[model samples]
Target: MKMIKTAFCLGLVWGASAYADPELHFVDLQEFNAALDAIEAGESPLSAMESYVAQASPVFQAYAQRYETSAASIADAYSERPGYYRSLPELEGYIRLREPEIVSALSRLEAMAPAGEVVPTYFMVADQRAGGTPVLAAGAAGPQINIAVAVDMIALTAETDMSEFPGGTGGRAEASDLPQVVIHENAHVLQLAAQGGLEAYRSIYSPEGGNMLAVAVREGCAEYLTYLASGWRLGDRHVYGEANERALWSEFEAVMDAPPFSVPGWFSGRHPDHADWPAQIGYWMGFRICEYHHQSAADSDAAVRDLFTLYRPDDLRPLAEAYGASLSAN
Candidate 1:
């Protein structure tokens, strides 16, 4: 697909980590955009990643620099770069969104944050962790599983939308979906704190680890928090955690039957919502456990704080004790 360049200058850069990475800095819009254009033209997300590593973490720079311009352009061209939509735009935009409506909605939710809730540190590409900015991979939340703390809110989208008009719906995806994507990726930021992310992921999984369950928990928490942040507007992933129960479960019978692709997981199956099938399931279902745990906790803020410690459904069984429920079946 052909990509076009757009004109723009710096407006803002954001992240998930509590403390910004010292190494994740960039030279503002001009230099960053030029570098990013080069990346979208032919650079691999991995190779292009290093150029972005710094106080601002390439993850943030990745989105800030090219996502809107490049990803949208490539998608506009309807190219075959399968990941062109997701890599360049989808994930990053979901994390550091620029849409006006979403921000306005967030402004109205401040009154809901429990005063005592220990707002988990917003996390992002860690300075110590290399291999580019591990935005979605590190994970974060209002609680601790890896490490407990109250997460004020996580941005998650209940998006199950997709298209192939040009750059695939993954880029200019949709508003409802951005929150979940944002929260899930940020959860990875939280993970970096407890396990050094890459190293911990390796230890939990296999030689090719990238622990899918951990990824799900990180993602799930983000989804759950997005709902908490949005006052449950994002929808419940747990109610349909079981594939058989989801509205599209029958259409996607084989979804979530395996782990995520470490090399670069991509699901191409087309359900009613494009390729949003199994991928959406992971984020939603995984989060349900956390949601249940959160609802059951006497002190909701404490539940948020305990979220980081959770890495799986089993981990949640004990956590949900306060709710007198067992998530072992999940």
Candidate 2:
């Protein structure tokens, strides 16, 4: 108890000390209002963060265990704080207080992280709130996240809480489809870190739109990475009832050749022929891209080093261009 309290106090002190200005890390209260206004105006703040905290709970615990408090300890310490009660603050201030430490840790991780290796493993959660903000844990959420318990959420409706989906299939995300969202958000973190240039996004999309290929690479990479990282291919579910690998592979091959746009479990966009498996296409293509690059590397570490280089759109255009590997082919 004493040690936990000490660490808790230290965290607060660190936050207070680092910020001679109490307003450190403060979101322009206006920005949040602007986000709500935009949402009201039909805009999405999916990526526009009110604020960013590098240390997700897992990152915080890893960091604290090595240096301060473990995640369990921090959670324990929160028992003493008022805002963390049953009716915790909607934005959760303690979660905010620890943000600096989390960011610092993530930065340090970026330096030591091996390329092509999954993000540091501490940054993922299977089920987060729907319509909630995306969180970063390790390596820009890397290209994939650990997915569990979530794929089944959209299938069940009678039960509630962790045991079942509250609103049922009508609520949010089908079991086979949840991974797309998981992969898409992680891809954003990866892409943003790999090469900050988004002028292309502006060129491809209107103020109201976003580029399809860019979105594909991001989403596809997430999908690919999720499988590479966990071996669960949501797309595989497409042929779940089939017993033969030959038949399954054949069906999958067809889906690949088919434009993925609006395929229920893959992608959403139609203009670019987005797939319900938008993320899967990324997985399908992005994995090949990463694998090709990873194998080309002189060493495993080089994989991470070269991740940024792989961000170029030219690498993906071939997938849609002549002589490009057809989406259906392995």
RMSD of each: 12.2, 15.4
**TM-score per candidate, in order?**
0.43, 0.35
Error of model 2, residue 68, in angstroms: 40
Model 1, span 1-330: residue lDDT tens: 001111211221123343332121223222334435656699754444344333333334443343332333323332333332233223334434433443433432222322211112122221111111122212243212111111111211343222323444332223344343333333444443333233333232332333444444555665566566554333343454454444433322233323543422222223344444433454554565567777767897677766654555345435424322343243
Evaluated at residue 187, the lDDT of candidate 1 is: 40
Count of clashing pairs, candidate 1:
57
Question: What would the per-residue lDDT of candidate 2 be over residues 234-298, giving only the tens digit for each residue?
Answer: 44432432233343233333444333232333333222332222323333443444444455456
Point out the worst 10-residue segment of candidate 2 by lDDT. 1-10
**Model 1: runs farther than 4 Å from truth?**
1-172, 175-183, 194-213, 230-278, 299-301, 312-330
**Among all candidates shown, the one with the greatest TM-score:** 1
Q: Identify the candidate with maximal lDDT.
A: 1
lDDT score for residue 242 of model 1:
55
TM-score of 2: 0.35
